[model samples]
Target: MTKAFIIPLLLWANSTYTQTSLNLKPGDTLTYSPRSDKPAWISIQSNEANMVVALFMDGKKVKEQDDSRGIKSVERLYYIPEKGRKYELKIWAKSYIERSKPVKISINESKNVDILKGQFSPDQLVEDLHTFRAIREQVNSGLYVYRSKKQIDSIYQQAETETRNSKTIFDFYKVIARLTGFEGSCHNYTDLPNHASYYLTQKSEYLPVTLKNIDGRLLQDSKGVAMPLGAEILSINGVPAKEMISRLAQYYFSDGFSMPYRETIGFDRGMLDKFYIEFGTHKNYVISYRWNGKVDEVSLPGISLENFKKLQESRHSLSFDKKLMSEKYSLTKEGEGIYRLSLRGFDFAVGQEDPAYKKFSVFLDQMIDTLEKEKIENLIVDLRGNTGGTGAVYEKVFTYLTQRPFRDSHYAYTKFNEVPMGEKLVITPLFLSNGVQDKNGLNAYLKQLYPKAVQGKYYWADDKNPSILPNEKTFKGQLYLLVDQRVASAASHLASLIKSYTNAVVIGKETVGGYYEHNGHLPLVYELPNTGIQTGFSIVHVIQDARNLPDQKKGQGIVPHIEVHQTDQEFLEQTDVYLKKVFEYMKK
Candidate 1:
């Protein structure tokens, strides 16, 4: 149980979006007994940058929010105090980073309220530190692959000691975050609980300039008050930029020791806050940067979080047209006898709302029909930025592409014969029956496909390998697949299929999410009671049998056949370097 003490204080708060504050400290659970005669709305904001709040009505959890970083509210509650009805509000730190950080919850109540604030003493800090140990235990047991047992053990052992001794909770969180990244899984890692995004934009502080990693160098991509654009960063504070990047990269990993993926996110604005969480938050930064082959120093002031968020949003507004986030799939004619098929995602609901949008199966069948009818000789399938969806959605893609029966294998672990109720909440409801639309028709089929659970962890084989034959409308043409590091999950699964089975040449950078193994499909979120630290873990281990596929890496992404890398200049100019390479290869 968490060590907590409640202060008996009755305060009146106006029913405004932002007003009234409740003191909440780490390792404490505040039970607020709110009294109202009628239905009311209460706005809640926590000082914990990364915290989880569960709303309970008389001890039953009614609502829960994880990865909460902004001011949130519990709306439309029926609380009749005259009828002896009561509502309890509980809040706690969700990660080691959130430990010791005091969060002020802003509550706007329709009626005058008596709020109970939970405060934790310094003595309770070690109880919160136990969260890190629990996290380490869970990760070590369930992760598909990690560093050698000794190495992982050593890292956790060091983190445990540091967590216990560290006075600042944020520093303790950084240790565990680094440990999580050491596993080298893109899907794994602990989010900084004290991130600035958790606070109100007006109250939060942010770095003055925007950063970008180009050609492996961290550079100023936008203009700052004192720094010019395209300035290469030499150092942050007193540490060399390269050294800082290496240190921070430990908190972010993308599938099997890929530094490029970390480099790409190194430019993200969120990195600014993450940096502060690891190091301490500062008001001014002395940056040593290089521009025009000459070293320069600049003192930049930090901007308000609201302003920085706007700046980041404005950057995306500039490149609204280039992104392929819309529509599940689209096919277009780029040239005579050549086609470009952009498969952005594999979701069933992606384009289904549009009256003109065809079903995914219909779209693929018609795409093949168009290719054959138009006598298309070359096809470029753009899988760039596709993070993947239901495996059943992409299974249809392989059904039409395969020339013979295809065999795929996976190993999974579960606590029961079917998915547990709590774990099922983690899966998309649309994918509950493997994307089958009809409940009556798919009930028996789903029951058969659910993997049987065993007592510990054990390997299992896929029993169903459907015989797939290429359709008559299949286009016998030169196939090219466009991929990038953003290609993940089910998308990576699709890439592995084409590269292994078909004559298609994969182009662009290596995909994210492992080519041979991934741990997902069902993720469970657990909150440590003592500290309120929360984390999500994949309950199942998915390993695709790639023995038939040659030149596969164990815990790495799918390597492209014809590598097409982009230059820093090309990226700044918004040039399609990879597409150009594809066209050039076709010409050859």
Candidate 2:
């Protein structure tokens, strides 16, 4: 991890060629080239079996650098150019029976490269900035913020320097990681496919069965149709399941997921498009199953990459993902013709002033109007997917539903600062004042003071919450409020309010379970060792009715009145476990 020498030598190729020779196999040489301008990609093609290609340059092994060969697969590509200098190349076979000749290379050419582009998205930049602030706050709040303002000034200066060289969004992801304070969180975090249209694409081929947990060396499939999930894998086009896992591991591990850092956490959610395997070392090539082996060996002329992605999204025989939304979060007519609407995930691409926000507001209004027309029994507001937003347009929504004017009673609390904190913060309750003491005891105080409160516009206090029309009723029918571990922040707030006031049945597992008041903060915070990440700070705390909720660990998440658990059998059975529970409760 040398700082000055962190810059890699770019390898460029002018042309492309598929190897007639099996490069990755044992005893075979695997090598390819890329264009000079972007010198990065390498093609590993060799006749050798289990070809182990290791890149050793200038007496140093470049293992951390991203290259071909799976996560564990050794690659023969160098980030630094060996233009004219002597460099070593090692390509060996697994069994040690086959290997490749060490072809010595020279590095003489040097391209006069100028400033590299700066890359980072607005949210990513804010996240990076927030990181530095957290570290500074923890290390010595006085020295970092109040004393000299050392960290802040330094970060602003560095960001000014880097943005001049960032290129694509990927580059943006990289640049911010390299910024201040991000340390562990900013390592190799790529905000790929965060956009509505852009899906994060893994480099592995999508296998037939959806994988749950790959314990030890055994591979388990959720689609129960297969007895021993691992046993059905059969072959990599008749090659072997174990070999396929090796190829797949490159993708799973390289993702740097499961990292404690906010930025480098793993991405098991996004799946790869497709896989191309040649069994028996290129003697036979077969495309893996896309829809649970429903249609194998895809019958098409020339397999293209676009078609490959389509096959993956087609959920034919897959189990439900825990974080996904299905029937539970839907809008439907009830006995009285009232609407039972369950919302999840911040799927709405709404902005405060944006038309999308207005559009969403209108959608809510329409739902209410429809319920009125249908003369429905009552509205069941299910917020299973509300990961949270500005609550985005909750204000606009409440107006249409509530019958009378209500003042926002929820207080906007915070530890006075220059930034606006988003309501989703882990805060320390400093101004419990006399209110917290009124709670049942110390347990309630811990939940309130240490970190529980939002200083945002998400919730409307009793006064702020509009009153129902004198002629109207409290969602007259049974309001089944569905929630889960995924319900968090604003969603949790809604769940809390629904549970406490309306006495709504909080169904599903515990919520991702967080609630508080906060607003956007941090003009920026930067990570120290981590790159391409910017951070920020904010001030505000959301302290809803804290006495009632459970402690911040096991019971912290909003629990369901009627509980439903995700079963191991569901993966194999492909049953809507949670939904089945929801519907069952609805029927009862």
Candidate 3:
């Protein structure tokens, strides 16, 4: 949980701002009246290491920045100010600190230039890299789960070397992206600040064509492009297709060594933005592809972000039924004796009384009644593209599929008993409680759940793991599980349980989430002191309830019994390849 600090409301009269900078002590409020209706950049410099500065517009908190471990003297915040409008700036130390030094605050008209195109000094980039590594080491429980400490140190060294010569934030992002990928946790990632991301999306330089990774080849999946559908792309610009894919793959991290997940996830619907980030803004792209057994090259102009999205919906070949993709959960009859349960995600509320949970309960009850009435013999549980959500939700789903009792995990633990770097941690609305904010609420919450938890030791979370009986009306038929690279966390946990305890025919590629274990739950995100780039990783390391099966590999996602990839024909036709394979298996 984030350490929440209370912002005291003080009545301040609007005053015409004549000075460029203002001095502020703890609990002091300074109001500035902007002369023009334009965006403004605010920077605060503090001798006090743990001070937080909050900007309020029209009595609403607009932005907040804290001095992060004194990595930099000046902490920056951005907001759009209207003419003749009053904005208030307040500074205060965290709850634990009693005294703090005065801070210097300054505001200036934001430049019209895109912040994404802005450059940082080589020293600043390297310092931010070190800060990034420090934060990860302190908070990430799975930092060395897949890669050794030496391997991680070498990755950071290489990143430092690359960051030293970096010109722009995107350039620095590439270096950081590689390190994040090497970290080998899907939950870990680095991204530009919100303001910078907003400015980037406003540009019309994103690649127009959407591509899909099929059988290790980049194939055009969008219409209106010069290349035909399913055209095998050989290169973009001067970079070979293989090399480009390899570079872009580093921008995404998957659990363990799931190479397919890293290679394929980046090229999905949001490929345009990923393409723009890896390869800089381009007005046009020179793409070479092999069409109808002939190598052809074409120069295609880039489209606006809006137009690119339009094309994805209107012309994308792999677009599924709108209703199917939008719903959280649905059950439909696939054939005379088979039923398809499409679980796009497991994001339902955990509390039984909560509307979300109640709704899911009603849906499941209705689904079971229909299945029993129809005497369905074959059931396909589609867990494709489900990144995961509430743990209780998936556990509920598992009860219907399994005959034996089970538990969600063998155990789960975090690196620390209290919030690490509480001063630098970002405070969100979720952390707010009655008048007082405690950053150590996470530890307190955990202690409440597990009274035996001790400091400097792994809390055996499942020491009292009582066996949960299967649902009384559980399905007593042949079960087929459909999963892919996108299945993760709770979804993957469910898959592991089914594979370990029951007889189910699993289809599709290996899941990106680990089969036996994963570092998940209670993710912590922090911004780099210099670059302001946000990095997040999970803190809880979990040993899942999975058996030592021959097919299940260590430090890897749950491998499907029958691994299936989308064929060229399936890609072009937008066919359900995994479902087709299931039907094929049933015919035998």
TM-score of each: 0.72, 0.44, 0.79
lDDT of 1 by residue, 1-588 (tens): 565444344454443333346666545676655544466655444533344556776678887755332222122232344365456766554432212346665545564333222233434545554654554454333443646778877877776676666654455556666766777666664543223333223333466766666556777766444676667888877888777677666656676665555656645634545665555545777899987789989887777755765666555223622465676688889888899888887755443343333466678888888988888888888888787776666666766666755544445543333332221121222233344322232334435544454565433435643444655556567888898877877778878878777778889888776787776554444343433334455544666644455656676688888877655556567677778888889888
Q: What is the lDDT of candidate 3?
A: 0.72
Q: Which stretches of candidate 1 lie over 4 Å from their true place?
A: 1-106, 109-144, 192-195, 199-205, 223-226, 316-322, 348-358, 407-410, 414-455, 458-472, 545-551
Off by over 4 Å in 3: 1-117, 195-205, 313-315, 321-323, 429-438, 449-455, 460-466
Ranking by lDDT: 3, 1, 2
Q: lDDT tens digits, residues 1-588, model 3?
A: 222222232222432122433455544455544443456554544433234668777788887775332322344455677765677666544322212334454443343323435468999998888888888888888888888989998888888889988988888978888888787787886776532333365567767677878868999888766679888999888888888778778888878888778888777744645666777667888988998889999997877866876776665554653544677888988887999998988876744566998889788888888999999988999888888998878888888888888886777777776767765564332333223244566557656444445665456445444567788788889999998888888888888888888778999988889888888876666667676666778777888888998877777888988988777777777788888899999999
RMSD (CA, Å), each prediction: 9.7, 18.9, 6.9
lDDT-best of 1 and 2 = 1
Give model 2's TM-score versus the native structure.
0.44
Candidate lDDT (C-alpha), each = 0.59, 0.38, 0.72
Q: Candidate 3: minimum summed lDDT over ten consecutive residues — where?
A: 1-10
The deviation in Å at residue 179 for candidate 3 is 1.6
Cα displacement (angstroms), candidate 2, residue 335, comes to 6.9
